[model samples]
Target: METVRPVETWLTDMDGVLVHEEDAIPGASDFIEALKASGKKFLVLTNNSIFTPRDLRARLLGSGIDVPEESIWTSALATADFLADQRPGGTAYVVGEAGMTTALHEIGYVMTERDPDYVVLGETRTYSFEAITKAIRLIEAGSRFIATNPDPSGPSPQGTLPATGSVAALISTATGRQPYYIGKPNPLMMRSALNRLEAHSETTVMIGDRMDTDIISGLEAGIRTVLVTTGSTRPDMIDTFPYRPTRVVDSVADLVELARAGSGEM
Candidate 1:
């Protein structure tokens, strides 16, 4: 029998695993605290490119979770990292909020509309027709197309709202170009986070609510995956997916003990 390596690192999705909308899930704070006490590497991951890590940190704090600013990883950051590696000091025509723009700017990327190197799309509550049109024209004009994530819809107090993926689809229909997505299920996001933690997949576990995104990405990145039922994916929906998580539980509350055990705190 193969001996399973003990988990040393954690990558958890932000929305379903930690918070839902503006509310933090029960025991989310305890789980984070346990991880910090464990002195293990960890990051709170989110595909929402609307907010920077600082903004996210504050929001999480508002929800009673005390994650450090550096411990949060957003899809915008991953996209910026990818772009910096692909073309150092490149220019882009951006269609995103401050999170996306700030990330690119930090990577020495200049945002412009005149013959840019890439047309970068990210999550934005105010996705304008003008900005998307510009992106379409730029892509048609030989600029590379890239998006932060492929989530078609995002949560709202009212109902589902169109997200980056939905807008990308519109652009693809108009320009015949499929934007390269760099978020969950892409594996690039996972690899980037792992690199940030300097952690190996064999000793890392990804905790997420969505099997399609979190579980798939973790599997592709060669890490253990845990599915929680507090978010998009429920227990009954587990068998619908051909892939399976290493484990499944009711919510992060249930994993607080495992988190403690992983660090020998139990």
Candidate 2:
């Protein structure tokens, strides 16, 4: 194999690798600081499309992660990017929260209920029956279907709640039109992030917790992947996956030294 170059850009999953719920994982703050001080391009990625980057930044700050708004990327943003590329200035019937809507609006997409070009599905706390029904009808009436991510359920203080994938399934059953998902493990999300950063796969690293979504997507994108055990996938579960990440570690804390070394801080 050719010698792997030093990492010049980084793509990291936000929820599990950096913060879990409202709490920052240990050393997550230092990791972010290291990435910033390295002067290397990096993006914090998340599949949740409920909040805008600004909102996520505030939330991370509350958790003491201190991730900048510009360094954050979401499924909503990736979906919007895909749509904008597929059909510039298109019209869509959106069934999502501020994150999805804001991204679409920023991309010059018009959200409408009648005669739309696409029916875009995204994650939201509240999934209104009326909105879903409208999406089904619009899709049945010839509008294309699109979704942010394929996560079937999301965590809540109460419990697991049906997410975008579950709703997309319902709509697909009703309309017989499967949505084109734009998040991991689609690889499109990773490629889009790489493109956004103008980074090459040979010199980019992806740090994530999930072997299925994050690791798979990074692998597909040809980026080196690091599996951290701070989130969904435990260390013992790593061997269960057919494909493996380039490296595995206990947590972001374990990689802080590597990050610092990359920045010439050693």
Candidate 3:
């Protein structure tokens, strides 16, 4: 048996792990502060591509969690990074919000609805039918399909709303082509985050709530994964999955002790 490496950096999910709707999870702030104090490179990750990092930072700050803008990595950023690396200055027909558009623009990607090289799908509060139609047409015309994340639904104040994955499926059904999902469960997102933090997978730990997206992605990326029960997944449901996280806990609150212990403070 191989001994696990001590955690030197941390990657965590945002929605269920840190905040729920606009509220901070209990002790989330302290866990983030402790990571900063311990001098460990860390990032708060989200599959939602509707908001930019600055926007997310403001939202988290409002909830009493002071995560830096640079410390927040969105699927929008990951998609853009992937595009830039795969085809620099590529043209795409974008079907998302400011977060997705701004990231593509920063990477010098031209957004066009006509004869684009790619059709990028992302999260939006209001996904337009016309836009979906256009995306379907583009994909039929040989535009490569890409999506920010594979989340079928996202949380809302009223209830769950159909997200990028649902819309992507609609488009795929129309065009008979599936999208290359760039977010969690792809492992590409994890590698991109690790690259952004200059962290190694062997010495980094991934903390998230969802087993399908978070744990699977981390495990495939060759990092230790911890599933916190404070979010989408319940402790009872964990055993249903054949793969397992390195550890499980009630919430991010318990991670404070683990982080401290890793730093030799406990």
Candidate 4:
């Protein structure tokens, strides 16, 4: 196969790529350092919306991956950005966690449960009937539905917890309205990351473990993609799937080596 051009920016998945269930992946810290050393810009674009961006950054740092606070972007942030463009100053009835409220509020979206213009969903450990009922009521009042991502469950050391998608499903089932997701596998996230780097698809490479979300987003965004085997995307499943990544490595360490070798640093 012909060699692809060197990567200028990396749009990476957060949960499984950098840390899984709050534990930093092996060599994740060094991977960040290598990218910084190569003058490459990277951001953790994750579907998780349980924590604010600042909080997530602190969590990652505590786990040994030292990434800049602003270098992190969550589905909550992307959802807010998308809403800002579509419904500036609109009242949003949020059905998620602190992350969703923080982001929507920061973007000037008013929080309201009465006659809201939008229903925003994010990750939440507690998915009570009252929250879903309120969202359904707003939908019945003609509120547009929006969601962070389609991750049905979150991975953790303990077990998988129902994610935002599950809540979105409840609202959808109750009101017959499907939400617009602003996370992985959606171009909204890819666009947000690109805007941050001010770069084009030709020079950007997406690195992730999931084919459905990460690689699909990258291909849709018209960028090269590399899949690593350290997370949800199992090794035996890669060849069986119709989707393909530009390259597949064993870990983040190999990702760094691949980038450096392409740039003549290896």
Best by lDDT: 1
- Model 2 C-alpha lDDT per residue in residues 169-233, reported as the tens digit of each score: 99999888899999999999999999999999988889999998999999999999999988889
For model 3, the local distance difference test gives: 0.92
Q: Give the distance in Å from residue 188's predicted Cα in candidate 3 to where it truly belongs.
A: 0.6
Query: What CA root-mean-square deviation does each model show from the true structure?
Result: 1.4, 1.6, 1.4, 2.0
Of 2 and 4, the candidate ahead on lDDT is 2
Residue-wise C-alpha lDDT for candidate 1, range 115-210, written one tens digit per residue: 999999999988898998899999999999999999999999999999999999999999999989999989999999999999999899999999
Error of 4 at 118 (Å): 0.4
Compared to the true structure, candidate 4 yields what TM-score? 0.94
lDDT of 4 by residue, 57-159 (tens): 8899899988887888898989998999887988988878899999989989899887888888888888778888888888888988889999888776788
Best by TM-score: 1
C-alpha lDDT of all candidate models, in order: 0.93, 0.91, 0.92, 0.84
Which segments of candidate 4 are over 4 A away from where they belong?
1-3, 258-266
Candidate 3 residue-wise lDDT at 214? 100
* lDDT digits (tens) for residues 66-89 of candidate 3: 999999999999999999999998
State the weakest 10-residue window (summed lDDT) of model 3: 257-266
